[model samples]
Target: MSQVSEKAVSFEPEEKKEKKEWKINVFAMLLVLLVIAAVITHILPAGKYEQIEKNGYTTVDPNSFKWIASTPLGFFDTVKSIPTGMVEAANIIFFILIIGGFFGVLKASGTVEALVSTMAKKLANREKLMIPIIMLFFALGGSLMGMAEEALVYVPLFIPLALAVGFDTITGTAMVLVGASVGFTTAIMNPFTVGLAQGIAGLPMYSGMGFRLVLFVVIYVIAVTFVYRHAMKVKRDPASGIYGKFDTNEQDSLLTAKVELTKRHKWILTAFLINYIILVFGVIKYEWYIKEIAALFIILTIIIAILGKISLDDTVESFTQGSASLIGGALIIGVSRAILVVLNQGHIIDPLLYQVSEEMKHVSPFLSVVGMYNFQVAIHFILASGSGHAMLTMPIMAPLADLLDITRQTAVLSFSFADGIGNIIFPTGGTLMAGLAIAGISWTRWARWILPLILIEYSIGLIAVIIAHLIGYGPS
Candidate 1:
């Protein structure tokens, strides 16, 4: 099965506009939320501060001046974050190379294409509910593939199918986001997010797969429900128009991305799989870190390029092109990090966290963490990207969980839910951008359809965590 034919992705114009409009709305909401948060923090009553200090919370020294003293340090703070930026740049480049190799091998061997085509044939007749089916397909894909980028190959095929079935482009784009987030947030298999979070929190790798799988199903159902409701609404009221005018010329076109892979592409895929298998074993036995895994990827890229009989120049060209495709996303990530640094430098993260943490302390020790967990959930709405927010805030949060007599696992789970839910509204997310662009949907349209669903699911997730705490699933 050829990869392209196996999956029917539609890159139609209507979906793209819906995504654009949704993004615009999300950006506006995020800005307003940030401003309101800032104003509230600025006007915090001194009595609350006194009560907070009485509760043993670490008080931010108003006269200590780290926040105000470094007013001009914002420029250099970005410079300092350059190392992180470089690391991110490298990660993006390597990810593209790895993805290209995997796709190339699958396409050349006809495995991916065959699978997609076979699946499509079975699904074509069920096309009336195509959005939900595609959402399920990508959710499974994300779990099995263990990589969100894998969706990039098939989103194009799904968009057109969506349009053909009388749904607009926004519905198509939303499907991809729903699937990716469900799989990503609750993935029992993906080593990227789950692995990093566990490793950092000093938990055993893959120890919590069962717990995560449960989350996966819940998130999937929530995502599907939200998407279905919005799609139905759009169908019922076309004049209520849940989309913006799509810019059909958005650069993430699948047509331009397709390239022919030679026979050796099969060997490269084999090599890639074998390499990862070895990596899994190595991590299990030797406690390898990300840098080690990265080294393995670099070595495999070089070896596969040679075995495929591709010239170094051609290999480099392909790799460069792949890297270039990700540059836009990479830049956005860096800028977002810069904004984070600004927020942190302003001493805002801790103060707000302290406020929430203090409130949680008054509750039962076992359930006190729920409030803090919910706080993260709220923060997720503003900082919708996952790793970006997690890496920035979890370190501070993990310790607070311990101090508050909360289970770290519970804290991690809450972070996961928040991180996952945040993506539903954040317009700056790469997956959302790519999915919308391909479908020709605008951000405003997407927000109109998906925001309510995001809120509902987030609410449900909080309830679930609360239930988990009540049932003695958490530590006191």
Candidate 2:
């Protein structure tokens, strides 16, 4: 849909008063759904009930509950199941805090601003090249940064530019979210997601880069085309639904302004350059953590804040608030963990895998496991958060691949496909949520436009993995 429509909703001053009420209602509904889904999923495992009878009914062992493992939960069983997810919840909370801290530093130091500005200059000048430029940026960033949060800050920066270029906010958000997601599955050297996936799957670090690069390009081409088509559609017909509720940021004007670079902005830019140089050398010379890399950003932010005369109080508050901005995204990761803990504790995960393999075994080898890519899809969906799904699926899928005679590398590639494309569909994903929030888009609106393209690309990517597997292009 186009960005110029009268039908499109605007979040300007008048809408603000009404939106607060609607947002609360929507949030309340989502919380209810999360609780209901968790409770039902936690109690649905029946296998633990069979074990309960075998172990004697009065056993008080906390682990005996097996929430999803037991088919039906008696009232007593549900009461006892609450503690099972505590650890998972804690783990997610801890990780988010650590990363959020880095975001605070980077944003305060103006490193993020500098980076976004550099990208904006390229994008604003080369409006027609937005799709490919975004695609390349996603791949390059994913390969180096190791996680997808790199896109979170940038998504906000790009949404305004997308609107200026004649696309609606939702379409803009879709391009960033879906484009980055595609990059994730096809990452060449990402340590957090791909590196972790290979580690669990027992492959060497960075072993599949050559093939993954191919995957990156293939997915990138498709995602870019999808985004460009939507952009063109918006340009052609401004009344389309895709442009609803498009909002522009005040900072966007600074990007388009032709003022001579100020001393403070220049120092901020210089700090960013030196910090990146140090970061690159660190990554190449020492396998330092990406979070640690972001530390340099924090240092630079402080220096720039002081030099820019932004005031100590404002700098402190910005750091505090910028870090706080990540809390909601972090919370989604935690909520997603609740889903995983229930699934894992139930012991249904392995049995679920066995069921999938058995079904595939009955069919021809050529079309079976690869065709049933949805099994990987399902496993990933259960652990629906991005990096979290990789951790959950890799250890399980790797061993299963061995038993089924599927190459481990090919299975890893399938896991990538399974994890990446589905995030486009699953609204629970944090990156997707952040993208929507930044662009003022809704889950309902995004799905209508992106799903068809995602499905087509998913089918093609799955076939590509199968072809790569058959051609003997992956690790043995």
Candidate 3:
């Protein structure tokens, strides 16, 4: 939900850890679901709905639902549907690639490193203030800019810094993980989750910023409070903290803290900030969609590369490398899209939707929102990639919301909060695992530490979705 770059999950038969591991590979999981969707087509009656686009948003005529001949996808068709799904989802896939490249160029220019160093230094002496301040910094990054994977690098950097200041590694690790997740849960302008979901739901990009901003502050405070309490506990009694088997001897080249914030770095960050402002204005005032947002990122990449004084060859290489890194994420989007393709071709989606409509019609509106929120939270364990989850679910959920008389924006918000909050507890989350690996904390330990907060945040997400539904959050 936060970062669009996906790292391939390593699922090699762990001869040693097989007895311990309980996770399924995301690719294998998606493929299995694709097959299941195909199988469902043969079992259920086929149906269709005539779609009509009004005011740029598309919706199905509920009364226009009709039976259609079943056209089940064969094995070859199902496999072929994967690439076709990519084609259908190309707009979102490319948007991720461009953002990856944009961030890559920024990374190559040493801007992010400088930014991190500057922040760490600014909070160096404020031992009591460190947890809240750094946590808020990351929360803002995630809510406004979608900073998940990028925040992973902070784990090692902050663990030692946190230890030196009398706090434990978990305290430092929680700052980034919890902070970024809180912002993600209350996403205001995050392109990957909220942006893509809104696009699919046919809502204006980054609309409803006001409510999200308020939620962001509330979540930020909650996250900071949790981390601060734990950090102080550890500060007072080191033995009370669960360090696991963390390797205190682990070292990194960046640990020396020599990355200087040069004037050029400041300018680059300023340009980065300005680009986001432009993106907000363009979307709000000019009605920019995916294409316009993508174009702005491309332009910003070029501008940042030039300002960073990166050589022409290096800039091109950086862009290529960045785009290449996100290939897995891009493919996940397309692969998830294929599931929809198979469902649509089988003519089963409409029937499924019809059933859902009937099933939800009698349910209380508030309970229905809560049910949707809980469903997203449960599903996030398997589909941890925020964009991938959006691609797989939004197309269906958007229309389903229309039938339930719930705003599609509410649906999008539900997905956002569900996917974002689940990441902190989901063992399958790569960034979570990576951060813990850096801190030398085990999954068991991390889960035990964060489970309470996870439940609290889950409740918050449910409330947010219910409120959104009551208020009719939407452009439609």
Candidate 4:
């Protein structure tokens, strides 16, 4: 799902703003691990477990672990794994590509810009509700559709609105960044995170949704409340805003420009809304996965391009350029998969799961659950792609959850919580980086303002994990 995000993302900042530069390159760090894992294969004992596939997801047979001859990966194999992992991760990689392409077509049509303009006009005076309302919209989008990179497109759009509302660039950025994060961290039906994790964990699609929906509301409240307080403070004192390199003269011109929605824009937006309705229906009723979801976007892309009367060449170019933008995210998915590739090829995955299961047995189930959450947070910091993270971890975590006397649902919850919360907070997260870049905000500055909210979001995840355990969350 990720290579596409890296490729399809194309944001033109209003102007280059000089600001503090922070360097913690996640890609270089993640790729280096491929070699590290290959080296570890020579030291970690080789073992295997029988795996059975059910409904298109793989589950390891916990009873079938057996020691195997070591097959350590040489340096050459580690280098070769880049392409191999991408090919293995094609399902999600392509899904992200098509989604990126689709959004490219949509953005090129100027509907998103038009919508942002409309929102700014209506919300100019209702500044107090902007945080709660705007953030709530983004939070709902995240829980419902696993929105992350999609939120980046709105970052530039919101900056002017924030300034117009007498707030800062950070406030505007937070509306798009943290707004979606609340629902993401407390996922309800996010196909990318909870859905993929749960499916691999061998639980029903969207099971235990009742508790998740509740968690979604609570987390959304916290997120909006946090952002609201900051927004209002900035509104009261323009000097209080963290504009970084943000210049009032340059940004003010953007807000002052007229953005009247035309009849064509109305038709285009209607088509977009209908497409989402179809998307939700297909996912819920037809049990659509990556291929189906990607196909839906392809169809919508065609419809939008035609209605917008964009030339075939322009449409293809836009789609291609957008798809190209997300290539990094897509490649990262494959490269990250290479780490698991080394572990799996060396037959050490089962032993690792076994060791983790043994460790959990020494602790309370609650502690085990928290450990799962924390481990996922650590993993998500490195592997930002939700589906890629799921493919890497769920095989081991599912059976480990079974062994720990905890429901797979709880394990999925932990994965969802960890996976979602880290996206905005971590420097490695492509979406977070992209959003900060688009808003012209520094990571250090964004972290200072959002760290407290991150802790609160983490607590919500912890509470949800604990509640899932106490409720014995599963039909499996």
Candidate 5:
């Protein structure tokens, strides 16, 4: 009877078994986008813009756009762009890997756990305060300096912190992503976006500071409120969280246990703070970029490993494990860059920009400015780099603003609003995708959760542009 039952089970149809739910892979999605971008190249007319070097900035001549021979990517070329994109984005990829390795060393050293545990205990009663405090800090970083990709390093730290505090990963992720985004969008003194755009538009650097400051306060309030409400809701009802259960089974003991910051942990924390101080100083004073920042982190990683009293082999192992955790995010960055590669190789970016700019010319000044704002948002998907987008579009938009009787300052504002806001939600944005990957959140899930915020910010952007036009926002 047992042999007969076994034979029956072995012959059971596979279709009778429960099927696993299919989840979309980010890499597969990027591959599909690569194919779609190639198809777009075939459909759209190719064109080129004559770029001129002015004040060490290469900007396109608005009137110099002309149709060019099409150069759409073939199948092999589409596949080849992946490695090319990886090569193009090598600095960013390596930066992310180094950050992972750094954090890995930090976490392995018990510094992160000790810090999170201390914070959790200290703020157990006032845990809600964390959202505003952390968000505001990151927002200031973004507004003061273009702090986008740099914010990713905080994701792993924030995730566990949020989890420890009875909040979800989304809440933690928002503290960095949305906070920095709000500040970046406002662009009070953000050199990468506002500074570059204004220089190209012939406005003094950060000229419209007063108005941007107003926007910053207003948007920061909205962002904090949004994140705070969500955090509280999750706290009150764990099931209300987006990620369902906050699974910390592995660390449940650590989270619930009393953790004190020891002398070594304090030293590690001080080292981190000093490193950040130097990083900011270098960025502002010397304009340090990827290569410099990566090297700094490598040094910090070594110092951290030594301070933690971790053996060399263990330190190396921790670094490797940490870097390995972020490999998915690093690849996402490469794939995101590939989309731009395909579009740039096809020479359609200029044509698309020309078409949109020409379309705006036929509208009223108010509507025209609004169109320009929307155009910046649309173009951001392909041209994700703030400085690159500014250089490519500002020269054209600045003159177009003049032709349409709008101020160049408003054009710059529109560009900043679009570029900054789009960074958090856009799948094509390498930083956003990389951050999402690190947080273990799918792009679709993030989009749904962030949709309302995006809508509110978009509305704010529209109003800001309209007000800029009505009141003549200019470099005074």
Candidate 6:
């Protein structure tokens, strides 16, 4: 057996063996997409839609689409778009960096470790219950506040707890990801998606809460159940877990460690909870966006450092280290945004939107609404931002719904469902990619593991769209 093992190892150099298992870097893949988008600009006809501003929102005039001179991106223009994309996405990129830094300070304070250790001890035997409880909390956050990027802050905390409880990293990820995504999809009060789409569609803000609330329950239950089943499987056989056979020494230490929350740790955690409360309040009352949230986290990081008695130099170093670790993931966001720049520069986005709207108009009302949902899903591959997607597409979908005898509220619902659901699986989604990067999971592995759940969610979305159309789900 030893001779055979030696022969097998000697058959290939270690570097060659590593090369055989290569995976595409997320940033590189997105850069290639940028090039592809630029190439398509030359292939597709260029067009523009007239825009009108209403109540501080700019929306497209569906009837105003017209062919325009194609200005496909030159090589220099294509290259320049990378920096422009970074600039355009700077708000979100910085938000991610600040979150990383905040979490770093929090981690350095021993708050994360103590909390995980405490949770692991309490839920050691009742591990299965953690799935639903944790998922429900995240789902509520997503449903209420549109918590996509914010969810990344929890991945590091949960992964250790998940492993401690006989689950794997993917389960921990899904606890946050699948939960938030489902809530975002149901979107009972998600201002980023449902609210923006409703406003653009000219419906009363949050008019269809009853319908969406029902969806929230149904979809949330489905998501929690799916994640629970997977966790159970992983618990029974570690090899069955996605990413396979993780080292359990750290997880075992978390469970066995006699970790007690010191006075400082407790105070730090209290401040942490208060920070989130402030965030939700600010978002709801003050209409806080990325900038406000980033500022909040900056303050919280300082507070955490102070409460933990971390030195000034140590705090700065921790913050810098944390931010540096996430730079790769954050840059992926910039690169993904570059694809949108290329399409816009090529002037093909409007033409694609116009083509879909025209195609939907020719179908039956049922098919047309379903087609709208599917179109939103497909479009999400390129346009991943929730509010941005709504602002661009809802203007046309709302009017097209009227022309097809479908309700504007239904159009808004289709948009929310597609946009939220697509966030989990789409490659162009910077938040999802960044979250995966934080968890140290490759996008391909995550995609493979989550694909089944996505199919189920997409089916739910399809059925919901159909029911909305059939029942004339409309403004209250």
TM-score of each: 0.60, 0.73, 0.64, 0.77, 0.93, 0.93
Better of 2 and 4 by TM-score: 4
- lDDT of prediction 6: 0.83
Q: Give the Cα error of residue 299 in candidate 2, in Å.
A: 3.3
The residue-by-residue lDDT of candidate 6 on 288-357, one tens digit each, is 8889989989999999998999999989987887787678778888888899999998998999999999
Compute the lDDT for candidate 1.
0.53
| Candidate scoring better on lDDT of 1 and 2 | 2
Inter-residue clash pairs, candidate 2: 45-68, 45-69, 45-70, 45-71, 46-70, 46-71, 69-346, 109-301
Clashes of each: 50, 8, 1, 18, 0, 0
lDDT tens per residue, model 4, 82-188:
78877877876776667667767877787655665566667777778777888888888888877665565456556656765567778888898888887777778
Task: State each model's CA lDDT, in order.
Answer: 0.53, 0.57, 0.71, 0.72, 0.83, 0.83
Model 2 TM-score, 2 decimals? 0.73
Residue-level lDDT tens digits of model 1 in 1-476? 32333232322234232222214433344344434444443454322112113122223332222222222234445455434533544544344334444333333344333333333345544745676677887776555334454455455445433443434456666687678777766656555554555555556665556666777777787778777776666556654433333222211122333434445655665776798677657665675544566576667767766776667676676555544434443444443333344354445655565566657756786567567667777776445455545554455556666777666666667777776666656653545544554444555656656778777767766776675555534322
Q: Comparing candidate 1 with candidate 2, which one achieves the higher TM-score?
A: 2
Lowest lDDT block of 10, candidate 4: 1-10
lDDT of 5 by residue, 1-476 (tens): 12221111111111211235345677888889889999999999899999888888778888899998889889999998999999999998988888878877887787777787787777777887899999999999999988888888787778767877788778888999998998889999999999999998989988999999999998999999999999889888876675422343422443565667899999998998899899899999999888998899999999998899999999998888778877888888888899999999999889988998899889899889889999999888878888888999999999999999999999999999998888888887878877776676777678888999899999999999999899999986
**lDDT for each residue of candidate 2 in 70-123, tens digit (9 for 90 to 100):** 543334443344344435554434434434444444444444444444555766
Instruction: Report how far off residue 70 is in candidate 3 (Å).
Output: 2.0
